[model samples]
Target: MKRLFLVLIPLALLAGCLEVDQHPHWVKGQYAGKKDDLPFQTHFHRDRLSWWGTISNRNQHQNEYNRANP
Candidate 1:
């Protein structure tokens, strides 16, 4: 049991050190609008206000006044 644990522990630690790419290959500039585009440009657009709109919409859902009184 002790020998098994000693070998497994080192293998587990080495596994964490391995580099892994979580994103799909197409995300690495293989698809349209991915290459030559600033990251999060759509989310931070001035006219659309995508990020702000999402936050405000979420807040509205959480607001007590917006919910039906129990």
Candidate 2:
């Protein structure tokens, strides 16, 4: 039991140094992804009001209070 403790104690202490640096390479305000567009720009043809109404109605349907009342 004493030998097991001596081996495990040092092994556990040195295990943390094996980790590689995982920080992102881009931190200087330059995006490295593809260009994106608004959700409603293509589907709803840039109709913000219609897109907002759809989102609001979907949220209402998912509400617990609205479901219990109905």
Candidate 3:
């Protein structure tokens, strides 16, 4: 049992060291990961004014005086 453990433990430790690196491959000046879509594009259907209005309302609600007065 001791001999089995000694052989298997070294083999298990070496298994991890032998793996190939998983760095992303880049295509000349091209992004290789997730595309960053604008929040307004997805959530507000690209209506710039509506997105700004929603942001303004959110910020106003976060103010302590606004909450107290309203």
Candidate 4:
């Protein structure tokens, strides 16, 4: 019991520090399945049931431009 707690505690703390590196150009649509020509700034088709696309954020200058113009 003591050994298990020691191991689990450190692992839990390390897990909190880990950040997942998901790319910006990956968007999962909300319409059941995939669709072509999403209004996102840039996009990629993922399989056939989803699309990977770019989203505009405070730091994404180009994405902001697309949103403003589109």
lDDT, each prediction: 0.73, 0.88, 0.89, 0.55
Cα lDDT tens digits, model 3, 4-43, are 9999998998888978988777789776888788999999
Q: Which candidate has the highest lDDT of all?
A: 3
Q: Which sections of candidate 4 miss by over 4 Å?
A: 21-36, 39-70
TM-score (C-alpha, index-matched) for candidate 1:
0.31
How much is 39 displaced in model 2, in angstroms? 5.9
Per lDDT, what order, best first? 3, 2, 1, 4
List TM-score per model, in order: 0.31, 0.51, 0.57, 0.29
lDDT of 2 at 17: 94
**Candidate 4 structure quality by residue, lDDT tens digits, 1-67:** 9999999998999986779876444447444445556433244433333332223234465565666
Please list the Cα RMSD from the true structure of every candidate, rounded to 1 decimal place. 7.9, 4.0, 3.7, 14.6
* TM-score, model 4 to reference: 0.29
Q: Which residue pairs in candidate 3 have backbone atoms (N, alpha carbon, C) closer than 3 angstroms, thus clashing?
A: none
The most accurate candidate by TM-score is: 3
> What TM-score does model 2 achieve against the real structure?
0.51
- Stretch of 10 with least lDDT, candidate 3: 23-32
Summarize candidate 2's per-residue lDDT along 1-70 as a digit string, tens digits.
Answer: 9999999999999999999997555657875665687998878999999999999999999999988955
